[model samples]
Target: MKKLYYVVIGLFAFAFIAYLFIKKEPLPTYNVDRYYIEGKENEILAKFLLAKDSSVIELDEGHFLLGQSLILDGVNNVTIRGKGIHKTVLSFKGQNKGAEGIRISNAQNITLENLTVEDAKGDNIKVMDTKGIIIRNVQSSWVGKVSEKNGAYAFYPVLCENVTIDGCISIGASDAGIYVGQSQEVTISNNTVFYNVAGIESENSTNVKIFGNEVYENTGGILVFDLPGLTRYGKNIEVFNNKIYNNNIKNYAPEGSIVGQTPSGTGALVLATENVHFHDNVFTNNKTTSIALSSYLLIYEMGKRDAEEEKSPDELGNGVASADKLNDEFLKDKKYNPYNRKIKIGVNSYSNSRWFPTLNNDFGKLLLFKKPFQTIDILWDGVVSPNTDYTICIDNTKDINFYNADLLNDFKNATTNESLYKCR
Candidate 1:
């Protein structure tokens, strides 16, 4: 008994020592004020917010009414957080000079969390030319009903890399509620979006994973597009495990906007993109085509834009070819392929919905004229690549019907051949 007692005591001592060795250190605390009233004396909030590296800027639990925008430029290793999403609100309803409510540019290692921004002239929160960005628990919107006068995008991140947008809410965006463009290595998850033209959009971006998002009551639930005028093309995207429903909002985007072309009640649209996979999503009551596979044929110069349009090397080129070289020697123009490729649609649940898509636009008119007999579940453009051994694959969605508009052939005919796309 004495020997066993000693052994037990030794074991407890060893465990305590191990716990001490493996325990995490306590996080550092700062002595700064939560209200951050440092630069309010001059009424210049931008001066107080010019954060340095390794800085934590916290907004107190209060409403900040600003006439001008808040700009965070060229900052690194900084965190801008609020007391809570509902507790801290930034209203730019009176903004007349600035284009956005909060604009962060040329930033790295930046974090924005627990804040609400609303009613700016342009995007509510725009992050550009950034790397290592994290946005969480943010709400952005317009105060009134959705209209073209509202900002284009609610939570907009373009020309960024390594971005993560989670636990966000958006409403009343004229264009996209959450728009990520010309970005790479992005993950957009756990968000709720409504009352927007396109609820969630990924344009000219690559290596994106959009999952666990709830999108409803928007003009279009989700869109993956590769529009012209961008240097990069979209590819390698995965959308899964999302709730897309009731996206029958009328399209109210301003004329000439890319989203203005999106017809009302569209559940999801994949246009002029590549290597996209959709799986395990719930679709119901969308009131339009549940899922559409299309090309830029209608948008990109009536589908006749040269696939090899060249671009000059500006300062912000894609870094494929060096910009320092003289004009003629290193001017290797990258070929732009606008055709959709390697699309896999699988295992998605669809209901008795989207049978009567709203006839609100020219596309809707054309669709109605071509195939007025029945509503479609999945609408493919019927634009095939020249080197195709069935670039599109569909699996596990046997209950739903399919339609091939053959849009490129002047919308002359349609077909419902499940064998044509069963390459998966």
Candidate 2:
């Protein structure tokens, strides 16, 4: 019995030493000399409200439940950071005032990093009319069931210049996870976006680069769009070196929204944009189409046809005439261009597991009617300006199939001719 007791004591000592050796060291505490905010929710709110120019506000490592939006307006050189992305969380789950969880307007040289913001009533983080912004190592999400009631955008920078969004994760946005609109000189890199209507979208932006991101499981992976009514038209955009796959999520955007018209299983979409380049991207498991190049006229005409069919099944053929009249009306504004021009697709890889396309929206149904047996790798609407030469160039993509839907002629001369789309 004495020998057994001694052996048991030895075993316990050995186990304790092993545990000590293998245990992880505690994370280093944030010790920078700055304005640190902690304690109750109201205290944090008061500190945020007191922030001024050149303020460095450091959030402590705790979850904060705030009632109103945090606004940083007309400040210069402001930095709002936290202990870590997972350690510091700001939730506006019950936000009653303001549309955005965190709103930065008319600011210059702002930086937001190392935090998580979730469940805002509108946009999680909205930066508008600001210049020189950096959003790094941030995470934004909407928890619970994914629905139209979720916010439209996670990280939204609109009408801003010199913006960079890097190393971020965004999820469950009804419209877009990361959206840069009407901005200039933007870089969005190394982000992970999923479960949104659009994973990443650049609308009416110029000199934009989207690279080094993993985008999957959204309704559409990446979109470069120039809408009709926007003052700015997108140009000089490059999308390269990204992994976009499995973007087959159902469309959850609210009715009448532009993104609500996006079909599921879209890997990349270029719509009414000029001088856009896509290269060195890997696309896999996108069920409907890998890359779709569309004109605003085609999308509008199809939507009109769908609506007409819903209202009066006998009025199917009148959509094209109505769409032409609307396009003419939109052309009254000289800045608006309805055709996609100078789109260069270079050296991208694509693989799909499913052969059949999605039939959830009108675009997908059109694809089904065009090709019943197989899915498309690349699709172009074949809508071009009658006065200008608009080209869709494809290089180093001989293995992937291409289709021209001939929307101008109403699919009377749809073709799979690769020679017509060779790079000029």
Candidate 3:
């Protein structure tokens, strides 16, 4: 019995020592507010040589090919600092390109400053479920292209709050240049975003402020959207004092867009967002529509839409309602995304002020003249085929049946019609 007791006691002692080594991290300790992380060589990911603590991790300048992965996990109160912005790169471009440029998950009170990243197959910078994060004076250039699965956006914050992005530059991203989703109290200011689908976009985010951004030359700039099927809603957006112009470029708009060439992440589209305000921005020289807002926010564009064009001159209401009706039929149970390929243009879309010249060419002639642009296609069930004459039935009541002259005439019929509804 005495010998057995000693054996058990010895085993317990060994296990306790093992726990201390495995669980305890190196450097700066847990939750230490101050520390520096440096890369030992340009050819290796020296900054990620060991498990990092919650302190500030400083990376050295020049190209770094990480032999392994650097994970800054649930560590809170951290800062990832490096040399000049766009100076240091983490290139997993070789055989093993990992998940993100700097994948930050579930950490709060973090600051990423004075750094540049490239060649990350996934999101260049991804922050998830984090709060009170700040990204200042940072640049991420040439994040992956759109052809591959992960080669997408430069910065994407999913499920975060109290975020601020200031004085940052992002270029050549497959998705929106800088994006945020499902967050509150967010601010994106003084950033230069270009060569992306949509410059700066937010979805299902509330109390958001996007100001002082030089968002230009992309397909579209500064888009705030909540279409359908997204698990959330977006409202209370304030856009002011920025140069939002020349976003209407030629060719099809990039991905995540809704208008130009099937509404890629094209310029400044707002949907179903309420209590929004846009003022003092220079919107000009864009190839496509300047600002495509919900029918409710049509007042926001003021004089941009010709008074005669808002309502169709046809027998029914404006064409958008027909487009909506057709959209419900085509997409079926899928939440209607105006950016989707079909049903993008309003019925009699050729006459709306937002209509483009090419729309009146071949495809436009077919749609407007009923000429059959190719095979007329429709959606019945979850399949795509040609169905010309089926009546659209909405399983979900969200669809609007406002066809032809319905929206504009009904909206202002009190003045346009004769009899008791005459304008004063």
Please give, for residues 1-424, the per-residue lDDT of candidate 1 as tens digits: 9999999999999688546433442311112112322334223364436668887877777666677788888889888888877688777777877889889999898999998887898889999999999999999988765667888889899999999999999988888999999999999999999888899999989999999999998889999987655668789999999999988767777644557667676789998788899999998876557788876544444312222243232431222112222122212433555567888888898874333445554555555556563455687888776654555788864777687777667657667776667754
Q: TM-score of every model?
A: 0.80, 0.85, 0.59
Q: Please give the ranking of all candidate structures by lDDT, highest first, separated by commas.
A: 2, 1, 3
Candidate 2: residue pairs that collide:
none
Count residue pairs with overlapping backbones in model 2: 0
Cα lDDT, all candidates: 0.76, 0.83, 0.52
Task: List runs of model 2 lying over 4 Å from the truth.
Answer: 1-39, 306-332, 387-389
Q: What's the lDDT for residue 115 in model 1?
A: 89
lDDT of 3 by residue, 162-189 (tens): 9999999876554567888878889999
Each prediction's number of clashing residue pairs: 0, 0, 18
Cα displacement (Å) at residue 32, model 3:
38
In model 2, what lDDT does residue 281 have?
A: 97
For model 3, the stretches where C-alpha displacement exceeds 4 angstroms are: 1-54, 67-69, 95-97, 143-150, 227-231, 249-266, 294-424
Best by TM-score: 2
